[model samples]
Target: MRFATVLAVPATILGAASAATTVPVTYEPKYDNGNFSLLGTACSDGQNGLVTKHYDTAGSLPSFPNVGGAFTVSGWNSSDCGSCYQLTWQNNSIYITAIDVTQQGFNIALAAMNNLTGNLAVQLGRVSASYDPADGSKCGF
Candidate 1:
């Protein structure tokens, strides 16, 4: 009886852990110049320079083109700084680093937004998304 109880507990925990949380996802226009400085972010002062170390610039377009994001304070806490989240929209998904805080929803860089929307980010500024804590490997940790 004891062994069965322990087994059941583990299974229940695993089942709950596998569930992803859903949120609204929007795009911000800060990556256009390829500048990934953490100067104005909430994590700028305390994340051990993780954002600067991992965020990379890709192009000089006038649109966001990076794999970074800001989460709403109500949904994510300070401990999530420098963490990664997999954002899914429709049939697309992308991994983004949490480097800042927003007022509402997950505000991702435009590049990540475009990817998730199949290059329709301009047409679809916001989308409903399912998010899960993901391996930071994809976001360069």
Candidate 2:
């Protein structure tokens, strides 16, 4: 009976580990200059439309011209906050965090995309960011 209980525990743990879903991600180079100018100010989140308002995270301001493969995902959800993703694009693989969301849920910033792929004009084929449930890294979350 003791052996059977231990075996069941491992199986249950494995089952839960396998439940993490792989989300497909695609992004285009689009600059959100509106949000760029408001950093470090009271209205940085979107006062008078001075910037493109991002989903507020506690007290952090959205980094504009987003760098370092910083990405935006679907919406503010408890399950999504503090999640990490393994993004891959032709000969390159980087681990980036999911921040905000837009009509196109998963997107890489213009500057960050440019850094990832040398030529912004080059179309990335089958780009994807795989979510890893165990990661505890937080960006805007």
Candidate 3:
């Protein structure tokens, strides 16, 4: 499956996006058409479920939760079908704070505001991909 990444940076005087060590995140990959899996050969096991990829290992996201879902990426908020954010943190060690998210699909959407702190990064609690009929590509984070 094609993967996108968002980063959150904390521990600094002000929130800044910095480089950090890599971590693997796992989730299911769905096509924009809403039917079948975008699960690529990279994602080999279905019964085992999807695999978590390193941010450096993937693409960009729509939002960045402040420091560990505590804050937003500098100046960004939720915008459905909008762009994604790469939230990250820094200090002794850099890591993922949280994924600030937006996209449209299914019956549920991410509409909660979080204020987290510490940790370089945190994996997404969950995700739902909606099928875009025109282009037929994945566009949800």
Candidate 4:
């Protein structure tokens, strides 16, 4: 149960060019070949029973309207996975795939991001996320 709490700014504030909204986003650590929890999903094929990764899907819990599958990123649209986005904090920035969404999808483990552990929450400089075309990148978002 590793998690990192991040402040998401509304896309409106960024400009009309985007429609993303402000929401509290928490990212957890995920590993390759991990099992899908009741609210979990997978990024590759052959992993049945779990929802296949999709752009429109959000890592929502099974209790949500479409059960284990629903593509809702608060301010983003469905079928928007094949896009590339940037997450910036302080002087660090990482490019991520808008690839998989889960009701409980783990983005990147907080442990890898920072060495500290134990469910800690920290405020980062005006966190900004922006999206662009995926450009044929692989390895899942």
Best by TM-score: 1
- The worst-scoring run of ten residues by lDDT in candidate 4 lies at 61-70
Summarize candidate 3's per-residue lDDT along 68-94 as a digit string, tens digits.
221221223222122222322121212
Evaluation by TM-score, superior candidate among 1 and 3: 1
C-alpha-based local distance difference test score of model 2: 0.40
Candidate 3 residues lying further than 4 Å off, grouped into runs, are 1-11, 14-30, 38-41, 46-48, 51-141
lDDT of 4 by residue, 1-141 (tens): 989998999877778744533322344444222343423333323322223433223333211111121123212233543334433333344444433454522143343223211223233311233322234332132
Looking at candidate 1, what is the lDDT of residue 126?
88
How much lDDT does each candidate structure score?
Answer: 0.64, 0.40, 0.24, 0.33
Q: Residue 41 in candidate 1 has what lDDT?
A: 61
Score candidate 4 by TM-score against the native: 0.34
lDDT string, candidate 1, 1-141, tens digits: 355443345666777845767788888777434665665566554444334444334232112354455554323326666677778877688877676677765887776788888988889888888887777676553
Worst 10 residues of 1 by lDDT: 55-64
TM-score of each: 0.68, 0.40, 0.17, 0.34
Candidate order (TM-score): 1, 2, 4, 3
